[model samples]
Target: MTIAEQYEYWQDVRKGLSRRSVLRAGVFGAAAVAAGPMLLGRPAYADTPGSAVVPFGRHLAFGNDPATQMRVGWQVPSAVANPVLRVGTSPTDLSQTVQAEIRNLRSDYGTGAPLEQYYGHAALDKLSPDTTYYYAVGHEGLEAASGPVNSFTTGPAGSGSGLKPFTFTAMGDQGASAQAALENAQITAQNPVFHLLAGDICYADPNGQGKLTDSYNPAVWDGYLKQIEPVAQSVPWMVATGNHDMEAWYSPNGYGGHAKRLDLPTNGPANCPSVYAFTYGNVAVLSLDANDVSYEIPANKDYSGGAQTSWLERTLADLRAKPTIDFIIVFFHHCAYAVTTSHVSDGGVREKWAPLFDKYNVDLVINGHNHMYERTDPIRGGKPTRTAGVGDTVSPVTDGTTYIVAGGGGASLYSLPSNGPESYAGNVKDASGVAAGYFGAGGKVTEAVDWSRVRYRGHNLLAVDVKPAAPGGTATLTVRGISVEGAKAGTEIDRITITRTASTVDTPAFGSGALLTGAALAAGAGYAGYAAWRKHRSGLDVPAS
Candidate 1:
């Protein structure tokens, strides 16, 4: 249809959609007036006597937290912490009536930038885990809908018996477009128990949806409510940031990603702010800041180098303290290993972060940066292994940690890297970039590659098959990838199953010899992988469908 025809079509659709927030938007007139390249503010509208509670807009809504605690989150007009929270049930389903509310106590989402506290969340304690409950944020008198708009399930109490596999979706770096939105909506349609992201929520290009909704919108957000609504409604959406969702959005220095737009459990480890960790069954999950560490541009610094790194180190240490925690999974926005010929493995990530993971016995590290689906072959120190299939790798006793770069949620496609200096588009480097390489444990970016396999540009999804330890034993963690089209039925191109020994799962036990033994084993096997590598061996190490 012609531009006018399309506009008319959407205009008619908007009539049925909810109206824009009645809140008064910021003054963009002055900024828009003298623009060389115009910058737009969120939808402008006069505050129609707004209520005390932040109104729940379509883009940003709460996700279900899988536990006895409800993860209540909402994107507000500004960074206001005045959202008085409370929970109540619709009379129709008042099976059990229990409610409570709490403020952020200290509500500045990790980014100390001058933000309007775009998102705020509270992990309502004392609720039943695995049980669905109707919840509301803000004041009780205001329109019940004005408060947090949705509800979610708390994490299963503590991993024990009688638990089933819970599903969560993972997507990121989706460039702003109806197609990207539609694909994401499709994945959400799976009705996953939860959804995890590796960052770059929206490419947020110059005319990006992020610009249209302010950074305040992240889910069913924007003009595509139909896409994210169903999934966000039933499942809790979990996330971490990527280069696409840079830490610079609200920055002079750098902003913390602790926005309320994405409903993350503020009750996570550390003063995590935007970064947090939680337990699901036998797994202990750790999500951190990758964007901060990669920011070496003139305008940015390596965020992961300083405080974030310290937090990471401490957090991993803390999770290890938990006894029931069978598997430890770490996720972030940047990929330590890149395969889109356009990008080289983040040697910096290998050198800097690999040691920590090795030391902690972190089973799987999931991230998105390259818009593709690729899994590393049980890496440690940055090296790839020969095989991590069902056999060679132990299922649960001493499985090595695996890393995955899953950045293809539905973003502007990143082409496979042709012969070149590895997707030179945005890798942060100084005159000594390739020379200095990536940082290892001590802020060193040396090329100590000993991690796993990786790919670039494949829009893929992840499926983690977590099987309980052979009853009283350590649990077996299996990870697989699914394409956007075939994801509903669940297809696998690459799969890795790692085993964590009983000793390794128990906290404060200084992870058993599993990490070291497995790493050494995989490292030994990796030599075969190296020999089999395209340039070296007769056969390549590509995954077979």
Candidate 2:
């Protein structure tokens, strides 16, 4: 069928009407009559060879325990009988079979017909740490081992001598475009243990305001998943939530579709699926839902009733107390400290979570929504502590937290404020006075600042190499911002090293009025309390999935 005819047919389906009804009403002329048989039940594309259900958009995610558990998720064109996953250490020797869970989603938000999608997830548990496993998805008619196979390496063991070096990539605002495809290829070349997508996964909802009036096309997700499947099938594509991800048709919170598509850790709050925590080796990663704390887009702000924030604080405290955890990284959608022209900064995120991050001494915070790559100097108490030029090293324990705006994953680039010469690594353009804004009530509040260190208006992604250290030693995280621009493609736009003591006892820089009881301190204190507590407590090294 023609594109116009297919669109009309889907519209009729979405409206609970069939093409036959539209034909009887004489809506179409000769073209509708020519495509009537194909539009009656299924589209022409649905007829595959042997009528076998083909799966696409295959992706992988880590469960609560990255060391021993992994979740594989994929989408099928149609519902198939007994979807299953086959796994083994060798592709030739497929030995394990796991049942898959189906999550079918239906949406009828636009004028077109309602759309229904089928997704399958299989949770593999009790796997060995640091092992490479091959897996494939299939159903009854199609043998699982007969399909194209992919492999993923489980994370290193959490404690003891098992701590090892690893690499991970992060980016956000990645839509299905050539730039996005380039960044994905770059990430695959890095061979990261996992990829942290800071939200804005796909531009399914172009108008990111969480409104019913926004153009919503669920098909965009299909192309996006297919585009990223080459990399995501091997590397766990860990994701957070962005404003564009808030589709009003999904659910009350607009994350029901996310829950159906991505199989993230459920250790967060009861209702908030986007907010979760996971740990790999010495690094603890927390994914937050920025829409709940965004002032600029208040459509879904404060929807979690403070539960997400409370969980974040508790999770931070817990991770900080573990001697095995050397770094704590938080990633979300809105920027807490960025100087881009599009969406400068989110005051709600700063007001709500900055203090908590300060108290816990978060190592690094990654954000998107600005559509550019901007980094800040080490910040504490809402101000830059020191100048962190590219290639410079900063100690998070003393200097403060570093914020990176890596919104250059895909989509159209947003221009940086034309205050000074274009600044980046190696070539520095120091801006004496840079005008910026913080989004809040009554729109943005313009201001001036000097913390906008490195700004690159192009497509980029963050490749971080983490080197673990023995107890009482020092660990380092080497962060590199790789540019995907035309001529400067694969060049480094920014680089920094975050060094911290591996397993030392350090006191948190608690803000004023932050009181902690003895029990609370014992439960949520630094490594000192955990070291003392470890003498009496012993259990599984990794959390259960």
Candidate 3:
């Protein structure tokens, strides 16, 4: 069938139409199913009845509030009875039991039996701030506490001087490869509080065009999850949707699969599952759904009807207005400024959200799509504000937004310009080695200027160390690109420091006039008091792990 015909058939399937009705409409026939398994959902591995229902793909994600809430998600081979999660301060004493919410997904592309997968999510709310919690997942036949236990540390108090330093890792286009597995181990060694998967997760849909003709294997998610479970089970594996994530058969918007498989924050505009915001320490991170605004792959473009962008601008403004949030980092799939030969940049992202990023002085923008590690010089108003070389310090408040394409997350590397001198940590290239590439609508327009700074074509992930400072001090985020391949595996190939004032609010005077000092001290004391009150209201303290 043609792409349009296949799309129509998938649409019918998405609408819950009966197979007879679909046949009556001549959407497909037995010949189509007989053509190949690619057109039909492949058979899932059989799990004998009475066998163990081991949970795999166990991952964690923060709720709207990272300080006191967490969502644990996992997958089982087949449907299980009474699936639940148990949490406690110690691995041996998981006393708090919560029933898991099961989301079952079925994919039937052709005439074969539909592929069925079961996912479970348990929300752990009102957790104590900065405390470690150990948890396990199980069903009726399995013992939750007896199973493998994973622990995660909650974020520090969201407000007041209690803010603590933290580390996080990010990368995209991570498929289930040996390189990806190696990267996961590298990420675990960083001891990040969370990990941002910029998108193209698992590449279940190889075509990634959101067309029915795209080859998809729902089981890829199974292996992919198990691959990252070592790290994801502890660190929040925050994810953004990429073009490959759009599975048309699942839902009208092609996110039903994701909705069922992953439990993400729902604080963004309604129906946009992947767009949300969370804060840890002094930095606020926004995860955007780039598929909604991707011009290169217009399959799911404008799916949110501008609501996503509107919410994004509002969220950015709100985050920027908060004195506690010193840095705002936005991450999505398609790149706004990349100079790769493949899928260089998305005009839609630049057109829709780049200005808002600049308007809010977004400290850093991380993207994935082109399968390589590329960073741009600090940019503002569609031009490079300054050339930010590797190991250089950049203040987004003054320099501009620094964009990094950390797509080398376990996926095969894409080609960098062979003729040009690519710059990276330990190697800085001058403008004399300018390379030409095309980027824009459909990534077809050719324009070759120089904003691409560091380019490394290897399996790598970003390790970011965030330091919180007092009201009048400077907070810093040190980003390092750690390669996962070759002799320099686990070595830093790129590094940049982003710094900003700790807060917009002024520090209280210590010993001024009696009246002025009294007022200032009272105000400072009131803020701290409020923070303590809020913490008390959230939950009682749990012993640190």
Candidate 4:
């Protein structure tokens, strides 16, 4: 469509969707004019009011703390006047109001197709812990439909507060597709407290590589957000960075678009804002940026200047030292130990970060990149500490970390090398089966390891039930893999139990030095330096999927 036609349609949208907000938007004329045309802002009569645009992609995230703070985010087709949020203890009386921050992101990929979108963000502060609150979005004369007044409950206040039980779901590679919508419905059915997107969130970049030759269509993000709103509108939808998320057309590192679309926590490392941590009840969750160290896709390798790894070590130490935090769940985009035929395990991940997980005795390490559901036995030092299977319970402090690859979040399915059904302890028809060789460390190793406990070629997501224990009780984490499509839709493909002492400190089987010894630390440091030097010399520019 021509520019004039586009403007006319947007104006028609305003007239048909919200007449009151448009009539009241004359006051914003001077402000829009002051913002200049590059931001796509204009005088009252020329621009469509944000309130009239009908906000879509409503989602939530934590504001540093999950108990008393929340960050509400949404998208608008155009700018509006003082976008605000009204929230309160009950939906009927949303008397408390807070002004929302507007991020005006304009996309022009040198293809003569320019698109502008306004993202609204609001951080709710000083909320009561363990309390449920209802909220609505819009500004001045406009308001979201009152029928669906969304509500969310805060987590427990502090550590060891006898927190109530909660459930959270996770998945990855959720591009806009019908299969993804089914998984989303299944996720909403679970009514989880929060959710995690491992990575490759929306394939707007298409290439899935951080390269300059990739084609980008920022409008695709609009559809992606609307698709996930069924569940994300209420649950805190936390996300990580994947290789497909990079947009080189925006900046040198190609994350300029990511920074605008999602308002993540700024409390992570100085170089990597996407990598952050937050605690809910007895669990401490950490989100990482695997693109910086992913070997399979080195398009944007070592982008974080080694600061991410250093910060991770310190964060793990701090969480493990706290007695209130029982479980440490680290999630990223790349697989540390996956046995899938497509995009096998990433060796750089294991070489750099797996040892840190072992040192802190992390309970669970979740990943997404393989596009399937797979689990590994409790592993330590490149080997399985115990053979875990269905109906089996394992202790992280005694055995090792459990790695789970739940990449089937709305994307196409990938099969194992064997092209067989899932392999469980009870259903292991052959012990000599080799699913696939791991990639990383400069070569592929064809070692037939038995750590592959369960592998299912289906679209699935992980639902983790965290049952907090009392002062002297046993706390347990129950994980269930739910299939979202095919004949096994809604069936549990895999389940496992992780038990920990309620109020005791965890004693890592491997001492601190045993994992990241002086020699290993030196090697890691040397590798980081070498990566930075190579990046500077190569001057490579690539886009993320």
Best by TM-score: 3
Over 1-545, each residue of candidate 2 has an lDDT whose tens digit, in order, gives 22223344434544566557656434445432332121123322233432378888999999999989999999987667678999999999878999997677765443355566778899999999999999999986778899999999998876634577889999999999877888876897788999999999899888887754466678788899999999999999999989898865545677767888989988999878989999999899999998888888887888888999988888887776566778899999999998877788999999999998887779999998888888889998999999989899998766889999999999898887779446898678878579888998778999888888899988899999999887657689999999987888788999999987665333232232233332364354433434343322221121111
**Candidate 4: regions farther than 4 A off:** 1-46, 49-51, 111-113, 143-148, 419-421, 424-430, 433-435, 441-445, 504-545
Best by lDDT: 2
lDDT of 4 by residue, 1-114 (tens): 221222333343333546554434333342332221222334222166544567779998987888889989988777777788889998899888888877877754324545
Lowest-scoring 10 consecutive residues by lDDT in candidate 2?
536-545
Comparing 2 and 4 on lDDT, the stronger one: 2
Write down the lDDT that model 3 would get.
Answer: 0.79
User: Cα RMSD (Å) between model 3 and the true structure?
Assistant: 8.4
Candidate 3's C-alpha runs over 4 A off are: 1-51, 109-112, 158-161, 436-443, 504-545
Q: RMSD of each candidate? A: 13.4, 8.4, 8.4, 12.3
Model 2 misplaced stretches (Cα beyond 4 Å): 1-51, 109-113, 504-519, 522-545
Model 2 sits at a Cα RMSD from the real structure of 8.4
Error of 1 at 216 (Å): 13
Q: Each candidate's lDDT (Cα)?
A: 0.48, 0.80, 0.79, 0.75
TM-score of 1: 0.65
